[model samples]
Target chain A: MTSPVVEVSHLRKTYPAAKRGGTPKTAVADVSFQVARGEIFGILGPNGAGKTTTVECLAGLRRSDGGTVRVLGQDPQADPLLIREHVGVQLQEAALHDKITVAEALDVFGSFYSERADPAELLDLLDLTAHRHQQFGKLSGGQKQRLSIALALVGKPQVAILDELTTGLDPAARRATWELVERVRDSGVTVLLVTHFMDEAERLCDRLVVIDGGRVVAEGTPSALIEGLEGDRGVRLRFADDGARERATQLLAALAERDADVTAAVPIGDEIEVTGTRKVLFAVVQELAAADVVPDDVRTLERTLEDVFVQVTGREYRVEENEEVAA
Target chain B: MTAVETTGPVRVNHEGLRFRAFWTLFGTELRVWLREPTGVFFALIFPSLLLLGLGLAVPDFSKPMADAPPPWNEAPGITSYLPTIIALAVGTISLTTMPVQFATFREKGILKRLSTTPMPPQNLIGVHMVINVLALIVSAGAAVVGGMVVLGVPFAADPLVVLLVLVLSTTAMFSLGLLVAARAEKGQTASGLGMLIYFPSLMFSGVWVPLSVMPDWMQEIGLYLPLGAAAQGLTMGWFGNEGFPLAQVLVLAVWTLVLFPLGVKLFRWT
Candidate 1:
């Protein structure tokens, strides 16, 4: 087995309680995970979920309250100078001077490291070659995001930590960022990604940890976690009318009779959502045919990371207001 | 991962890092400051206006008193006021202009972005200090030459004493500016606070008015302030006078030692 490139054990961080007076808020509580060398490890959480604080600690930007975090086998806090040389960090709200041009910023940062990628090469890779002469303040949101990524990669670090890689990007830019991340991973650099986008996590992460209220509630490969749920399969059936909905409910009941582990039959709008195994879903479809209620739309889809997240944590995904405030 | 065997003490290549970081940031600051004529106007032009205005308004009061007074015999009024004005210009540029610049850098996360690299934080501070010190020197030279041509104030011929005074006063003011930059939370706040501290020092530190003309209690108070002592020392050195005020030099030195560490301790990158 390859050794873990990033190791965090029993990590904890606590912020001072608010002025109203209560217990101190635990930003990260007993969080632990390891990213194997050359694999992408993602941390998925809602806003105020301690994602930023956790990555800051890992990057040696903040002192950890408790627990050990080692990047490239060096203690980040104790030896930040050493770790900074090998670890590249792209903070969520990081920015540069308005008057400094993109190429100038890249060249300046490149001078800090012992070994660095050529600024021209990095600009091309990040699609920022054309905007090299543009001042940082003149760039659009997507352009700035691309510049931030270029700055992170200029040092050619062994481990790269990107926080909210595609937070405010349009769909097209988001897809481009995804491709860039995959290419980075393919180049043999370990990536620790912090994102709230479920699809992004499912697509990019080889293994992930779901964090909520400062703790890791679940951790595994996306597929493994989804499969771990008991009778976690889901079926969507759009019916003709209220009569079809009633008949679909009856069909689901018949299918549950065959499997003791079937959990729920929820009706949403004109569709009935059946949650159970592949066997139960197939039986439910046959029962619907027997009842002579032909469904208009019928499809069986695997449970997504979002579904598994909500089910395991009992909390809906919420985008916090402060997520955009940093920008 | 490849491992290398080492038998001797590990050495860090701080020279290369420091040199590279310093020049990179210095070049960036010079380019931005030059391009933004408005910023340069406010930083360099405004202070020059103040110096030329004050130098003209205050006449040679020390010369008339030179015939009667013991201390005034060697240092005349215009000669005394010249060094104080120079010191004030240095104070204005470093303490006021530099802090606001650094605060904006913090607001924009430029400093935070730099912190992620192998460059040490001291190099950033050092670059700012060096650039502002050079600006101060040029401002001082312009103020002296312009004061001579426009205000009829005579320039001192002794370059050695002028150089010594410039070195001491510049170091003292640069360290003070670092203290302000480290403490102020916002750019406007730092600029405002700098003016608040600077205006009073210019008024009571004998930059605009001689301490001898003020009440005895005011003169005693002026001796304790850093700029007041600096002005006193510069005046004594510029005119080839006796009684160099070792006590005042000691006080300024102490201020430098105390404020520099406190400034560094309080400094925030973001």
Candidate 2:
């Protein structure tokens, strides 16, 4: 059997507590997973979920207290030098010296590898050719992120790891970055992406592992997880007036009685959202038709990955911690 | 062009990884130092100013005894002060610049980023040391020239002795700076603590006052300090004096040998 591009087993990391702390913090605990060659494997989690810690261990930046991590079939801890040749890493807060020009930084990083991709080509790929002579500090936030990806690709690594690739990007730039990631994967490099954004995972990841409280909570394709939660599907109905809303509410109540699985009827804005399984949803629609309670808009939508996450983990998709969002 | 072979023939190599890593870090240090005029001014100009200011302000006591002879009469006072000024300057740059640079690099996540690469931590420190040593030599030369021009100080005819003294003194100061830089948690703390060491060394090593005039016990204690030994060696070299104390050389050497490895061991990349 062919070996996986990346393999981790029983990885653990614990840090000593600070003064006035109750107990030591376990950043990661016995986490294990494997990524097939040329596939985009994502790590999805909330803040403080140990996603970054796990990736750091895989990158050989932080030493794990226990367990084995192998990248490209070489031990990251024992053979970090060998592993680095095949793996490119773009850390969340990593940056170059402010005064260093983009081209110079690329050249300098390129020199670290025995075989390197053409700097000009990389710059063009990341849409940074125009900023080749500009200083690193002078670049915009999106430009800097792109330049970082260029640096990582310079080595022509077989495996690339990206942490928070598009956390602060606007929608347009985020879409561009997603396309860039797909291009990177198409070049035959396996990708290990770490992000908290469920939309990003659903759009880009072939498969993903959800981490919470320093352990794996779930692992599967985005479609599979959403499919698993389809039984709890819901329909949102919008009405033109309060009278229409009242009529829809009475119709939903009757539908709930007919279908035992119709768990809740929620009122949102000028609409009443009905939630239940496929069978329950069908019964609700039939009952509404029988009552002639035709609403302004009625749409059936399956549970998204976000909804599945909320149901299983009992937490919403928290894109920002309070401190980070304030900053 | 011959079909630019881009397939299996193209393989990542690690043959020159060590050299490449070292040079990249070394270039980074030099580039940053060159770009910052304030840093260059303090590292180079401050020592020159201290040497000229103190040498001219103080009396020339190289003449024969008026009151049982000034203790520094055996050597030209300016010459004695010159080495201490150089040592202090070397210490200032290494301790002040290195730790601050390291701390800022850590705070900026540059060190953490570099750690993900194939480069070892030793290469990072080695590059910093190399760049610092080069800067130290350049600053020390300027100080010597400044002393000669401003204070009319004479050079030792024995080039070998001068070189030896500079080497030993630089080694000692560099080790001390490394120790401070490695231990300090923050840039401000490193700079403040380094200055704490710098002021005392300047006072006790006879950079500001003649060590010979100090009490006999004070002189004995100063002999053990690397800065004092360096100052004395430079004095002996510049005046072309014989009977330069071997103990001073030994003391500086011992400090270099002991502190350097300890500094490296304690150093934090992040």
Candidate 3:
């Protein structure tokens, strides 16, 4: 494959102390990832997880204390003008003048680029044509988000960095924004998505890096990350009584001893929980059928990206922390 | 990408691109400024309106001063107030309009957003300066022309000298205003700080009490401040035959020299 469109390796950034004699804070410790062309690459992390810092470095808005970042084979800090011309950034909490109309905002930003996308086409794609004349301050939250996306693509940028693009949108609006993002990617623009939403990452990212405490804890496609969890799948079976449960436990123990897929079989209350590989469910049922032992009810647990995130970060995802740490 | 292929036809003229971006932002900002009634009224029309109001309201406002030097004594009293009004025009735009606009842009993250583009946020500051300076010129011109037609005020003895003084005065006042804008966190704070400095500037420029009537010690101090020096320099250029107002011009030059670079150094993009 050709070199990735965006390359970042061992990236580190530290914010100076806000006051004299205060200790400096490290926002990004060691983040390394490469985004291939035409892929929706995601930087997934909880609040204060350095996702914003990573993209800010990639956009040349912030200087990393260590490591290196190259967008379209140009160093962001060294060739910031060229990088800015080619990389469209949708920064979180960044807004246009309140009085600027939607179309005016797009036009002004488009004027900054040598090659511009058709504003009418972009507005249609983002479903913002009806609100083209609305002032920025008057637009609804979803409309504002969509306009931001439109501005990001108005330059016909080769790489677009969208930071928390759908953070405040409702479910329907978020879905629409996601579709617009997909369309942008399909139009030959490589997208670097920074988000704390696991579902967004799972649904949109071709590959993502899970960042925690300023470091990449896990990196893979959403399904691969979920599968990377060791013995994460399981089967739960409830029995009529403890007598049947005990018999089932013995049979499952025997199964576990013989089969490599059965990692564990533990009894909780009247239900015996079997934890193992994806095929463990079928293997456990076969073992029970051989003994003519039946389960009252059975359910299989499927791991999701959320579970993978929790497993990798060793903490629940908290979105309310307000990631203003970089400021 | 398609952009790369299209780039072949579009020659890499970096300077030309930057100039185009500048004019685009400049036009947009000028429109935004004009749309706001308060900004346009205060910056563009208030000085002339104040002149017209004072000319009509105050009795014997057009009479020649009884105790003034030479040709200036022969000129109408309203003409003596012209310098102060010109200073007021530059002061209002610089302190009240420019600083608040800049601080609010920073507060609202407009500057930060612009910084992500090829054109830096400093371009916006430069645009603000150009627009505000133009407002100052228009306001000063309106006041002078209005004074001539309504209050029988005479034109400056040397229009060139008056323009030179206005330029120096504008530079000094704008530098001071930019210093306030450099670090203010909010529009409210900037306006508050602006007013704090603005009232004192008007006082020193003798807006209420003519500098000629002030005690020698008071006038000495007033000559040192930017607007005060501006008022004195403008007065000298308008009516004085005692040669150029080198001392007042030097005072304004010092103010610009000290404050402009300091403001530029202290300014923050985000």
Candidate 4:
């Protein structure tokens, strides 16, 4: 087997308490993955899900308390000076000097490497030519994001680690950046991207690992992962009265028995939910009508990656507003 | 990937890489500060402006004191203010400007951005140090020449000793500034600390009262502080009356020794 360009095994990191004597919180726990050469790999997670910490450890920005990580076949922390020159990193919330112009920022960063790409080419590629002399503080949100990407690519690094790569970009700009990433990959640079955007992961990633509560909940190609989410879509039905509700419940049970695809028929409060394949909903509505029950409200929930996330992690994918762990 | 230079026992272009990296960042830093004319105002212009303002307001300041007292014998009133003006150059650049700029860069992640590459981010701090040193030199030179032509204060009676005192005093003050930059995590904290240090150090440089005229208790305290020692050293150099202010110079040297390492150790790139 060919060696992976990046490999992380049994990784763990914990942050000290925010207060003087509070208990420490683990930011990453037992995370493991490997990135093959030339692949556009991804770490997909909600805010504060240890995605950033995992990559920060890879970039040697944060030292992992346990486990091992090798990037381009060397330890990033033990040999940061050697590793730094070969890897390009775009930090999640990092900023440039407010007064520094875009062109000057590019020039200074480009000089840090022995072999660097022509910055003018990168400027044209990222569509930052017009704003070359504009101060970083004056650029629009998308412009700032593009300039940041430009700086990351300026060194012509072997692997690029981009964290939250498209947070502030407009939809069109986000798509454009995705295409740019594809081009970077085509030229044979391994990209390790961290993002919460499902469409971005599906559209760009060759393979990805889903992180939740500082652990790897799922990992695979986007389609395979979604398919492995038990391929569930739910049909929620509410009846007008208790008689109709009970009738509907029996009918769902009867239908689930006859159909091989109906995975579950469960009562959630005053409603009934039938979960299975796409055919389950059609079979369910037909059986309900045949039983002479009229439903007051009915809704269909299709399984996307977002749903897959909930299924695997057992929680909604939203910002962890109360994470004691810090930035 | 070919973009990554493969590992080998021998490294090539080490010198070329060093020179290129240094000049690129160093020159860019110089240009960035050049855009900010306010640095000139604070470092060079402030000292002379303060002197010109004070010289005009006080009539007897321009006239040398008659039958000067033992310690004040070498220092007339206006002559004392000239060295304090030079000390002002050292104080503002070191305490106010250096710490603020250093902390702002770290707060903004400018230093973090640079750290991802082969270049060490703290070299950015070195660039700032170089520029501030140059500013101190220019301002000190301007104060000495301006005192001679504008205020009729005599030139340094011992030029070599004056330069040596300026170097030692600047090292002392900037080391203190470095310590503040190392510990301060935010721009607000850096500025607050800078101002806290700047005002007291300015006073101790003895701009308002010649140390010889100050109460015994105050002089006793001021002599131990870097700025106070600097004030006395510069005045002694101006009078041509010193071998070296050994006690005062030692005080300044000790401060540089203690603070510079602590600052470098405490500084966080991010």
| Strongest candidate by TM-score | 3
Decide which is better by DockQ, 1 or 3.
Answer: 3
Off by over 4 Å in 1: A14-25, A231-233, A239-267, A290-293, A300-302, A319-327, B1-14, B36-38, B53-81, B157-159, B206-217, B241-247
CA lDDT, every model vs. true structure: 0.75, 0.76, 0.86, 0.82
Best by DockQ: 4
Better of 1 and 4 by DockQ: 4
| Interface RMSD (Cα, Å) for model 1 | 4.9
Candidate 4 local lDDT, A84-163, one digit each (tens): 76788887664787678999989988887777889889899889999999988889887888888888888888789988
Model 4 interface RMSD over true interface Cα atoms = 4.8
Alpha-carbon shift of residue A14 in model 1 (angstroms): 4.1
**C-alpha RMSD over true interface residues, model 2:** 8.6
DockQ (Cα-based) per candidate?
Answer: 0.34, 0.29, 0.36, 0.40
lDDT of 3 by residue, B75-192 (tens): 7788878888999999999899988999999898888888787778989999988998888879998999999998889899878878898999999989999999999989999999
DockQ of 1: 0.34
Candidate 4 Cα misplacement greater than 4 A, ranges:
A234-275, A281-301, A321-324, B1-13, B68-77
**Model 3 stretches with alpha carbons more than 4 Å out:** A231-302, A320-323, B1-11, B67-75
Top-lDDT candidate index: 3
User: What fraction of the native alpha-carbon contacts across the interface, defined at 8 angstroms, is recovered by model 1?
Assistant: 0.44
For model 4 chain B, give the 10-residue run with minimal summed lDDT: B3-12
Q: RMSD for each model, in Å, please?
A: 4.5, 4.9, 4.0, 4.5
- Give lDDT tens digits, candidate 1, residues A160-191: 89989798899999999989988889987789
Predicted structure 1: lDDT = 0.75
**What's the CA RMSD of model 3 in angstroms?**
4.0
Chain A of candidate 3 gets a TM-score of: 0.86
